[model samples]
Every structure is written in C-alpha cells, then in structure tokens.
Target chain A: MKRIRTAVQIIFTIFTNGYAYGFLRGKIYQGNLKYACVPGLNCYSCPGAVGSCPLGALQALLNRRGFQVPFAMLGFFFLFGSLFGRFICGWLCPFGLVQDLLHKIPLSRKRKRLPFHHILKYGKYVVLICLVGAGSLFLFGGFAKVPAFCKYLCPSGTLFGALPLLASNEALRDQAGGLFSWKLGILIVLLILSVKVYRPFCQYLCPLGAIYGWFNRFSLVQVHWEKERCISCGACQRACPVDLAPEEISRSAECIRCGKCAAACPEGCLHFSKKPGPNPDTKPDLKPEKRT
Target chain B: MNVMNQWNQKGGSRQHGSRGWLFGLLVGAAFLCIGGIRGELAVIWQKAVMICMECIGIG
Candidate 1:
C-alpha cells in the first residue's frame, strides 16, 4: 500500500507540476500540459497556467490600487488553507516537495535538531507584510511597479518563475537588472539553506503555510485523537516533520495533518475525521429513566 | 507511556487495513494515465486536485 501510494505521488508530481510542460513552454502557449503546476517552480508569467498561482494573483492584486486590500487572493488563500491547513505544503505544493527533496542529504549530526529557532519561524509573515507594503506604495503611478517579493525575495519565483521567462523572451532578460540579480541571490541563499535544513521555508518562512495554519483548528478536515487511549509513548511527536509535539497538540491549528504521526503510532488512536474530535469531556447517556 | 499502552489496547471498529490507500492510488494513477492519454488539460487539473486531496492527510 505504501509503495503504491508513493508511486502515485511520484506520477502525479511528474505530470501535474509540468515537469513535462517545461519541455514544451514557449513553443506554443496553448499546450495541453500547460495546466499542470509545471514542476521545478516555473513562473506563472511563462503563460501556460489555466489558473494563476495564489502568490502571482496576490502580487497582481497588491500591485493594482482599486481595492484597499488584496481581498480576492486573500480569500482564495484562506479557503485553501481552511480546507487543508499545511497539507498543501506537505502533499500538493510543487515547491514544498522541492525543499523536501533537497533536505534529505546525508549529514552526520552531533545533535539532530537545531539549537536556534528563536525568531526565524516568522519569516513568511515578514515576507508577506514587507513585500505587500512596498508594492502597494508603488502602485499609484507616482512610482513604477516592481514585484517586490518576486524581486527581492521568493526563491521559488526566481528559480522556477524567472528562468523560464528568461529563456522564452530575450527582451525580458535584456531588460532585467539589479532586481533579477537580487532574486537570484535570495535563491542562492535558499539553496544553501535547503541543503542544510529540513524545509526552512515551511518551518519559518512560508506565508502560505502560516495562513493555512490559522485554519487547521477549525477546518472540517482534521487529525482526530482518542485521548482516552493515549499512552504518551511519544512516537507521534517524534514522527512529526514540522517538529510539533503531536501528542500535546495532536490536532493543533499549526499541524498540517500529515500522517507521519499516524504512521508512527503503534496504536491506532490517530486518524482523520470530518468531525474534529473524540472529545474527552463528552459523556454518553446512561440514564435509567430512559427505560421508562 | 501508560496512556499510550491503553491506547494500543483500546481497539474499536475494525479498519480495512490500508486498502483505502491502495484504492486511492489506483484512482490517482488512472487519472494521471488518462490525462496523459487524452491530453485533456481541464481533466488533468481536476484529477491533480483530487489526488492531492487524498494524498493530503485529510482525504
């Protein structure tokens, strides 16, 4: 079963993200595979997306001034996050899988976990506010628009989004300047980090993951625990990829609901449920008067 | 540790024991193969979304 599921995952990642589409980009704009995520973080600007990426849409909305907020993209992010939490980060996000693949290099450790994580986890929100704020300032035509996040940050956009654009249009590459250079530097830093760490972006820097985490507590989709049966062996906590103590906050809003905890559970106590919990406080009716 | 031991013992309804994953994989593979075969972009996206949903811990 695990092998089959893994194979399915491999095949889907191959086709959906346009690992195939990159081979076909720019030859024709209307290729059949253009709809896929187009593996390796291809840019939305390459022009094959039937539906725009949430980040691209967010950038577009922020760069236009009619709305005080980028509400449409915000709503989409919330809806996706609410439905799956960081599950998208785990299973579907094309870039996330990239980070995961990079983090698996063999490295001996005197200590397995990092000693310092004091403030890095908040990087994504910083990415969110700083870039959005800067872009908003330039949108009024008093200044020309530059996608600040795409320019100064966002390794995915640099590696996946910009390369394809550069390859396809000589004009765009010729027009590029320090902004493109800046994104390349960010991508380089991210590449070095990915080699050493286990998904630093998702851990401390993915605004998408942060947004989704807000909804994990209330989403219909959930990790349900039978607390009554919990023995506290600590397997679930260790199995968690995000380093969350799964037993303490088994269904925590921050949890992406990844099954590593369940898979690690020698006990069958952890499972997904449409309803949120095996609520410990609730009691079943045992009233004698009901017999009357 | 004791609570976990109890959990290990507290079996409830019988699980199908991983058949669900098998079924999901077959369905997902079918979507991928079919999408590849027919060149239906919309169908490819829809199937991709569905596969991602199940592969997601939730379902």
Candidate 2:
C-alpha cells in the first residue's frame, strides 16, 4: 500500500510538472492549463508546473485592484476538500513527497512530534486566515497586489520555482536579493527538519493542509474505525506518522489518511471506507480478539 | 423498538451525509460557473503566465 501510494505521488508529481522544455529553458509553461488549479501546494511559477497553485490563485484574486471575491478558487477548494480532504497531501503534493523522502534519511533520532506540537498545529490556520486571507486583501499598497504567503513564506516556491529559475537564468540569479535569501533559508531549515520530524510543514504551516483539514470529517473518503474491533492497544497511534490515535479520533481534522495507522492495526479495526457509518457487521458486544 | 429506532436514526444520518456531499458538489459547481462567467479564469491565466517575482521571493 505504501509503495502504491509512493508510485501515485511520483506519477502525479510528474503529470503536474511534465513540461520538459520549461525546465531546460528556465521558463514557466504559459499554456491554457495554467488557468486550472492543482489540488496541492505546487507553485505556478515553477518552470515545469502546468497548473496554478490554488493558494497563490486565491491570494492573487484577493489582491486584485478591485474588491472582487475569488469565487472560482473558493469553488476549487470546496470541491477538492469535499472529495479528498488531506488525502491530497498524503498522496499528491510534491513537497509532501519531498518531506516523506527526506524523513527516510538515516538519523540518530527521528522525532514523531515536534516541540509544542499541539499549540503549533494552529499556526497553519493563522496563516490561512491572516497571510493568505487578510494580508493579501488588506495589506497591499495602492495599485500593487501582494501574494503574502507566496512572497513571504512558501518554501515550495523557493525549492521548485525560484531555485530552478535562478539555476538556469543568470539574470534571475543576479536579481536575487535579501527576500530570496530569507526564503531560501526557510527552505533549508524546513528540509533539514524534515529529516528528523515527519512532515513539519503539513503538521504546522501549510495553509492548503489547513483548508483540506476542515473537510476531513465529511470528505468522500475517510479512515473509518470500527469501535467494536478495537482492542485498546496503542499500536495504531504509535504507527501514526502525525501522532494521531486513529481509534479515538477517527474523524480528526489532522489525519492526512496516510493509512499508517490502518497498516499498523493488528485487529483490522481501522480501514478506509467511502460511506460515513459504522460497519454493518459490527457487534457492539463482541469481545476484542487477541492477536497472535 | 429501541433497536429499530437506532437503526432508523443511523439510516437517516447516512442519508443526510450523502445529501450533504451532493449539495456541496452542487454549490462548488455553481460558484465555479459564476466565476468563469465573470472572467475569473482569464484573470488566473494572466497572473499565472507572468513571472511573479514576489512569488519567487526575488523582489
């Protein structure tokens, strides 16, 4: 299952960023497909990206000269959130793939949870509300629009868009200034942290993750937990990459549905289901089966 | 009677959940069409094609 997910991630990454010429020439794809938004944190400015970043599009629309609402981008978010929730993060996002790969590197101590993990989880919501929402809408100077999150904090843009563009284009390299340095520093720190911590960005900082998380409870696909089959063992929680106890918080907003918990369950209590209800065969009074 | 009531309640909730999902899809589609009619897709295209220096954190 993990291998299948990795293959899907790699395939989707390539499919979304398949413009070979763009990478060679240090130019973004200027085709009509750029108008369509991908359901992940890909940067539109990426040399090989064929679709727009939904967060970037939202900010751009909000920062437009007039006070026009970004109805289409909101709709895009709504549709994707309702359908997949953070399953996109687990299986589609290129940066998530990057972090997943980075976390596999040999480390003395790989921490499952970061410092202040509980308090820090709310930071992404703050970013969603402030940087992506209000900062783009209200903090722009007259006649100039600002994509606050993309401009100030997005490491994905720095890694996939800026670094590649600068690598090929000497003019863009020369144009790099303090802002570029700052964003690059952020990228480096996040990448380094990824080696030790599991998906620091997704757990704490991604506005896109925060958006998708809101739909976890009602999304079309979900990690369903059969309460009757749970044996009170903590194996699922221990195996969870993001430290969520799937048996207790079956519909938790923070669950990315990576199936780590499901994979770890010895009793087959946790499973993915399309329908939002208890198992038809559930026997509430059934005894917990002992696992060999 | 109690078991029947519980089963009926579960069935109703499941039906409600499906309805909510369909309603969400409909709402999303409606807003998408409205935005397209208002030329939002073109606006997105214009922004995306242009090299957003700020987005790259270069400026």
Candidate 3:
C-alpha cells in the first residue's frame, strides 16, 4: 500500500509539475493549461506546476483587477472536499508525500507523539477560516501585493517554487531579503518537524486539509466499521501512522484515509465502506456487538 | 452530549451519508455554472500565464 501510494504521489507530482526544464530556463510555464486546479496542494509558482494552487487562486481572487468573488475556485473546493475528503491528502498531495518520506528517516527516540496533538488538529481549520479565507479578503483586498499565506507562511512556495528559482537564477540571489529568510526559516522548521512528526504540517497547518476534513463525514469514500468482527485488540491504533483510534477512522476530521489502520486490524474489523453504516455510536469498544 | 445528539437526530447517518455526494454534485455544478458566467477559466489562465513574482517573494 505504501509503495502504491508513493507511486501515485510521484505520478501526481510529475503530472502537476512536469516542466522540469523550466528551472534551467528560469521561466515559469505560461501555457493555457495553467487555468485548471489540481485536487492537492502544489505551488502555482512551481516551474513544473501545470495547474494553479487553490489557496493561491483564492488569495489571487481577492486582489484580482475587478474584485470578483472567485465562485469557481470556491466551487472546486466544495466539489473536491465533498467528494474525496482527505483522500487527496493521503494519496495525491506532493507536500504530504514529501513529509511521509521524511518521516521514514531513522529516529532513535521512536517519534514522540506531541502531547497536545489531537487538540492541535483544530489549528488547521482556524488557518483555513482565518488565514486563507479572511486574510485574503482583508489584507490582499487592501491591494497588498502578495497573498498572505504564500508570502508569509506556505513552505511549499519556498521549497518547490522559490528555492528552485533561487538556485537556478543567479540574479534572484541579490533580491533575497528578510521575507525570503523568514520563509526559508519556516520551511527548515517544517522540514525538521516532518522528520520527527508524522505530517506535522498536515495535522496542524494545512488549510486544504482543514477544508477536506469537514467533508469526511459526508464523503462517498470513507473507512467503514464492522461492529460484528472479533476482539478490539489495540492493534489498529498501534499501527496507525497518524495515531488515530480505529473508531475515529472516518468520523474524525484528522483521518487521512491512509488505510494503515485497516491493514493492521488482526480481526479484519475495519474496511473502507463506500456506503455509510447505520451505527450511531462513535466509540469502538462500547459497541453493542462487541459487548455481545 | 445532548446538543450533539440533537444535531445527530436532525439527520440520520444514512441520510447524512447520501447528502455528502448530493451536496458535492450540487456544488460542483454550481461552480461550473458560475465559472462559465464569470469566465473564471480565463482568470485562472491569466494568473497562470503571468509569473507571480510576489508569490516567490522576488518582488
């Protein structure tokens, strides 16, 4: 599953940003194909990115020449969020893929689960609503030249877009100043955190994940629970890379739908349910069938 | 928990589940409709064609 997921990630990364030679030319792709938006987060400034980043597009809408509300971009967000939920984060996002790979590096301390991790899950939603949603309209609406998130915080812009541009273009180095250093600092911190934590950015910062997570309750694709299956041995929780409980599989907004928990269940109690189950109870251990 | 249950009671899990796809379709259709009218595709195209130097922090 990991192999397949990695392959899918690679394919998506390539398909979205395939213009590899653009770095050498120090030119971004200026083709008509740029109009479309991909489901996952990829920087619009990425020389190879064929599609626009939704966050950037949303921010772009705020300062657009004619002050349009960007219904089309919002529509894309609604459509993707409602359909697949965080499945895009699990399987498609290049940034997610990078974090997953970074996490594989050998750590002797055995990955300390942050104490307030679950509580921090709500942070992404705040970022989505405040930074991505409102900040664009308020700050950028005032004719602030740059989108708030991209200019201030997005590490993907720094890693995939800015760094590559800086490396290839000699003239760009002289232009680097306080903001570049600040963004680079953020990118470095996130890179180190990715090594120590499982998708730290996805858990606490990604606005895209926050949007998709809200749709998880309603998404057609979700992890199903089989109440009648065997013992509730804590294997699934132990196996979960993101450390999600088996019961919280699809119910919690934190679930990435990575299928690690389903694979680790010894009793085969968990499976991806296309249709929603009738169970009202959210807790796995308290289920009536398990009691019986 | 009472408030939560009341919220849950308003929509059964099955109905809630189905609403997911229904809402998705409706929103997707709405986006396409508005996009067509606003010529949002052109907006996206124009943004894409222009190098966002500010995004890269060069400007």
Candidate 4:
C-alpha cells in the first residue's frame, strides 16, 4: 500500500508538472488547464505546472483591486476538502513526497514529534489566517497587492518553482537578489529538518494542510476504527508517523490518512472506509491491557 | 494515565454524519457555478498564465 501510494504521488507530481517543453525552454505553460486549481500545494510558477495552485489562486483573488469574496477558490477548497481532506497532503503533494523521501535518509534518528509539537502545530493556522488571509486582503503598495505567503514563506515555491526556473533560465538567475536568498535559506532549513522529522512543513507551516484538516472529520474518505475488536496494542500508535493515537486516528485533523496505522494494527480492526461507522472519538468500554 | 488515555477521557468529539459531506458537496458545487458565472475562472486563468514573480520569491 505504501509503495502504491509512493507511485501515485510520483505519477501525480509528473502529471501536474508534465509540460516537458516548458522546462526545456525555461518558460511556464500558458495553457487552458491553468484555469483549474490543483488540490495540493504545487507552485503555479513551476515551469511545467499544468494547473494553478489553490493557495496562489486564493491569494490572487483576495489581493485583487476590488475586494470581493473568493467564492471560486473557496468552492474548490470545499469540494476537495469534502472528498479527501488531508489525503491530498499524504498522497498528492509533491512537497510531501519530497519530505517523505528526505525522512527515509539515514542522516539522524527519525523523531515522531518535534519539540512543543502540540503548541507548534497551530503555527499553520496562524500562517493561514495572517499571511494568506489578512496580509493579502489588507497590505498593498499604491496599486500593487502582495501575495504575502507566496512572496515570503512557501517553500514549495522555492523548491519546485524558483530553483527549477533558475536552473534553466539564466535571466531569472541573474535577477535573483536578497529576497531569493531569504526564501532559499528557508527552503534549506526545511529540507534539512525533513531528514530528522516527519513532514515538519506539513505539520507546522502549510496553509493548505490547515484548510483541509478542518474537513478530516467529515470527509468522504476516512479511517474507521472498530472498538469491538480485541486488543489495544500500541502498534498503531507506534506506527503512526505523526504520533496520532488509535482513538484519534479516525477524526483527528492532523491525520493525513497515510494508512500506516491501519497496516500496523495486529487485529483487523482499523481500516479505511467510505461508509461511516461509529463516531471516531467514541471511547471503548474495554480497558487497555497492562503491558509488562 | 498515558496521553491517549488522557485524550479519551477528555472526549469532546463533534459529530457530523454522512449528511454533512453530502451537504458540503452540494454547497461547493453551487458556489463553483456561481463563481464561474461571475467570470472568476477567467480571472484565475489570466493570473496563472503569467509568471508570478512573487511565487518564485523574485519580485
């Protein structure tokens, strides 16, 4: 299942960024497909990107001259969030794949949670509300509006959009200045942290993840936990990359639906299901067996 | 008690059944149609086709 997921991630990444000619010529694809927004945190400026990024589209809509509600982008978010929630983060995001691969490297002992993980996870929400929401809507320079998150924070843009563009376009490289350096520095730190942590960016910084996470409890696709099944072995908790407990597996906003917990379950209790079962947060009457 | 036990004891789960998702899908579709009618998709196309300098952290 993990292999299949990895294959899907790779294939989707390639499909989203499939315009070989754009990469070769150091130009972005100016196609009709750009009208549609992709579900993940892919960069719109990526040379080969076939679709606009949802976050970028939202920011652009908010930053427009006339202040209007971003109904289209909100619709896109609602539609995607209802369907899969953060399953898109787990299986579709190119940056997630990069972080997954980086964590596999034997650079240091892999940690499940970062320091102050509980408090720090809320950072993504702060970023979403402040940078993507308020910064785009309020901050302006005379006639120009700034997409604050894209300009300052989005490591996906730095990695997939800027680096690829710079590598192929000498003009773009020559134009690189202090701003580019700052973004690059952020990208470097994130990439390095990926080796020691499981998706630090997704856990702490991604606005898209913050948005999709809200729908995890109500999404069509979901992880179902069967309370009747015997044995509350800690395997599922141990296997969970993000440190989510068995009870939290079904409804937790942080769950990316990677299926590692389900796979790790010794009893055939935990499973992914489209059909709704018992409420995820319902506690079992059976007590957990004391481990010697 | 372990962290899981502590969390389970706290028990503040909000329940939204299958109807919730169905309603969400309908709302999303309706909003999408309205936005399309307003030519918001064309705005997205126009913005996306051009190289976003800010996206690349350049300008």
Off by over 4 Å in 3: A65-68, A140-145, A277-280, A286-292, B1-5, B9-13
Instruction: Give me the runs in candidate 2 sitting further than 4 Å from their true place.
Output: A277-292, B1-16
Per-prediction share of native contacts kept: 0.04, 0.61, 0.57, 0.64
Candidate topping DockQ: 3
All DockQ scores = 0.04, 0.39, 0.59, 0.48
Tens-digit lDDT string for candidate 3 (A1-292): 6678789888989888899788787668887777778888888888788888888887777656546778888788778877788989999899999998898898634453666876887888888777776666666433464477777788888888898878887787679888888888988998898888888899899998888887887788888777667367778788787777665676667888888877888778787777754445545554334443
- What is the TM-score of each predicted model, taking all chains together? 0.67, 0.91, 0.91, 0.93
Regions of candidate 4 where Cα sits further than 4 Å from its true position: A285-292, B1-15
lDDT of 1 by residue, B1-59 (tens): 37633432452101211232233334445554554454333433333222111111111
DockQ of candidate model 3: 0.59
After superposition on all CA atoms, what RMSD does each candidate show versus the true structure?
12.2, 4.8, 2.7, 3.6
Which model, 1 or 2, shows the larger lDDT?
A: 2
User: What lDDT does model 2 reach?
Assistant: 0.84
Fraction of the native A-B contacts that model 1 recovers: 0.04
- lDDT by residue (tens digit), candidate 1, A264-292: 77767777765455332233233322221
lDDT of each: 0.51, 0.84, 0.78, 0.87
List of clashing residue pairs for candidate 2: none
Which docking category, incorrect, acceptable, medium or high, applies to candidate 4?
A: acceptable
Local accuracy of candidate 2 as per-residue lDDT tens digits, A1-292: 7888899999999999999898999999999998899999999999999999998889888988778888998788778888887899999999999999999999748998788998999999999999999889878645686889998999999999998999998989999999999999999999999999999999999999999987765678778877766786778889988887553334466888888888888888788887554523333443546778
Question: Which 10-residue window in model 4 chain B sums to the lowest lDDT?
Answer: B8-17
* Per-residue accuracy of model 4 over A1-292 as CA lDDT, tens digit each: 7898899999999999998888888899999998899889999899989999999999988988779988898888889898898999999999999999999999899997799998999999999999999989987756788999999999999998999899999999999999999999999999999999999999999999999998887788888887778377778889999998777777687999999988889887888887444655565655675555
